[model samples]
Target: MNYDEALSYINDKSKFGSKLGLASIGKLLEKLGNPQDGLKIIHLAGTNGKGSTSAYLSNCIMEAGYSVGSFTSPFLERFNERISLNGRDIPDEDLAKFTVKIRTAANEMIEDGLEHPTTFEIVTALAFLYYNQEDPDYVVLEVGLGGRFDSTNIIRESLCSIITTIDYDHINELGDTLEKIAYQKAGIIKKDGLVISYPQKEEVVKVLKDVSKDMGAELIFSTEDIEVVEKTDYGSKFNYEFNGIQLNNIKTSMIGEYQIYNATLAVTALLVLKEKGLIQIKNEDIYNGIFNTKWKGRLEILKRDPIFLIDGAHNLQGIEKLSGVLKLFKYKKLILGLSILKDKDVDSMLDYLMPLADIVISTEVSIARKLSAEKLADKIKKYDKEIFVEKNIKEAVLKSIELADKDDMIVFGGSLYLIGEVRTIVNLL
Candidate 1:
């Protein structure tokens, strides 16, 4: 199959839906010779910051002269962004090749009476197969959903399991309560393995501690060991201590107060990796990696003249962080373009962002699950009376630009799908 055909074939598996268990993936991997086995993995699971944390670690490892594979989800521009090696996306030819092999294995699994693999499961299997073939020194694996039964959890152990801030997300599948969500995220902690985490809520902390104790895993907290010395829109300067060694003035290019915690977690995980003798990396490499790491669609500035910014703040926590960051910018007016998925907490997210906008333009992405622009406008009317409905994302962006002045700021967010569409329309990708 060709690249486009391969993508279509894989996307067609969406008819199988998103199953959360590892059975089908495990069976599929077994058919593919269990490619996940013997891999040194840095498995990460959380509601947010997973991709940023994964980017920081993978870049650091790669800078240390080691081959690193990173697997993430919900690509902003292309499907190839989901699977990358040493900062380069999977080549089109390799993607086609892996799809053909995995498609054959999937067919055999169905022939053996196993259920058809879900799209996420097939993609996970493809990543494992690709990384296995490449034989990278380390693979940074981010969970697609709740970690316990996630297909990526098929790996029995990891070099280090990192759990970023856990919050209410995918509640329909993970659970409704914070403790339940924390339990699901904590499932990535392997028996007797080292686990690193960002500071979590009180309930989340209890759940993580309990799970770590039960699993016999050593738990380390980044919040307790890392301190932010200074922060700005450009980045942050921080200090971290590990094993009685104090490292000062650690810097990162990822801007946001919360990103300080994510960067610190990445650094801490890498330090643990170094101590375990799994990899040798100097402090200079760590510093360079942090400074060089970039994760798109999170408070990204697309244009400076009209001050256009786009962020993928689809959840409550994400929206809260975005709102906080917006406070630091000086603008004459806030022109907002927003869209969200049906399953998100739209009311709360709207409540958080609507008050900050002078004029709101509601829009929907091309995805089937996206909330209609009209319905979203209705939801926003409660918070802000000045709401405009544009069903097309591109039109919504154009409308936003028309309403904004040079000193005003135009911010587009609510869903990654929405931001992706606008990014493509604006040629920011």
Candidate 2:
């Protein structure tokens, strides 16, 4: 199949979506010769900051003179973004070629009495296949959802498993409470392997400790001795003082106070790798990688004149972070365009955004599970009855640009799909 056809074929599996099992993925990979076993991976899992943490870790690995493969989820601007090597997205021809091979393997699985692979399972298999073909020194893999049953779990023991901060997302599949979510995220921690985690609530921390003990795995809590000194719009400066471990100046390209935690996780993972004698990473590599890393759509400032900002702050925790950042910019007028999954806390998200928005414009993207534009506008109206609605995403973006003054900001986010659409409209690709 071609690229578009491959996309359609893979996405069609969403009809039998979210099987929540590794069996299908395992079988699918077996048919593809289990390429995941040929590579070393720093497997990352969490509700938020997983992408940023992965990006930070990939940068550090690259700075160590290693060609790294990065596999993330829910592409921001293109499907190719989900897979990358040395910070470059997978080429279109490579993607099309791999898609056809995986499709054939998946069909064989179905003919062998196995269910067709879910969309994530197929993508996961494709990543393993591509990464093995390229033979990168390190692969930074981000879990698509809760770790236990997520297809990405099909990998062998990771070099180190890093769990970032967790919050309420995919509640049905994972669990409701923070402790339950922590359990699911900790599922990626393998037997007798190294696991690194950031500071979390008491309940989550307790769960991690319990699970770590049960699995015979060594768990390193970053908050046990690390701290962030200060933060600005550009980056953060911090000292990560692990017990009898390295104390150094760590910097990250990702903005926001929470990114400090992500940097700590990445550093902690590197230290774990260092202890294992798998790599000899330097403090300069950490500093340079942190500054050089780039993961888009999280508090991304696209243009300055009208201040076009795009963020992937879809959940309550993410929305709260976005709200905190929005408070810093002193823009008088705000134009907003948001498209999100139906399962998201739309009302809670609006509670944070509506207070800041002067003109709230709503629109839907091309996702199958996108919340309706009219429904989103109606919900926003409940928060601020004067909000406007536009069904066309590009039109909504242009409307925001039209209404904003030079100092005003046009903030578009709610889903990565929305950010992807804005990138297309603004020719940011």
Best by TM-score: 1
TM-score, every prediction: 0.96, 0.94
lDDT of each: 0.88, 0.83
lDDT of 2 by residue, 261-280 (tens): 77778888887788779888
Error of 1 at 426 (Å): 1.3
Candidate 1 lDDT tens digits, 1-429: 999998898888354576666778888889999999988899999998998899999888888999999999889999999999988999999999989989999899889987778888888988998998899999999998889988899999999899998999989899999999999999989999989998889999999999999999999887467778877767788888877768889898777888877888888888887888978999989988998998888888888768888998889999999999888788989999989999999988988888889999988888788899989888887774688899978789889888888999999999988887788888742
Clashes of 1: 0
Error of model 2, residue 412, in angstroms: 1.2
Model 1 whole-model lDDT (C-alpha atoms): 0.88
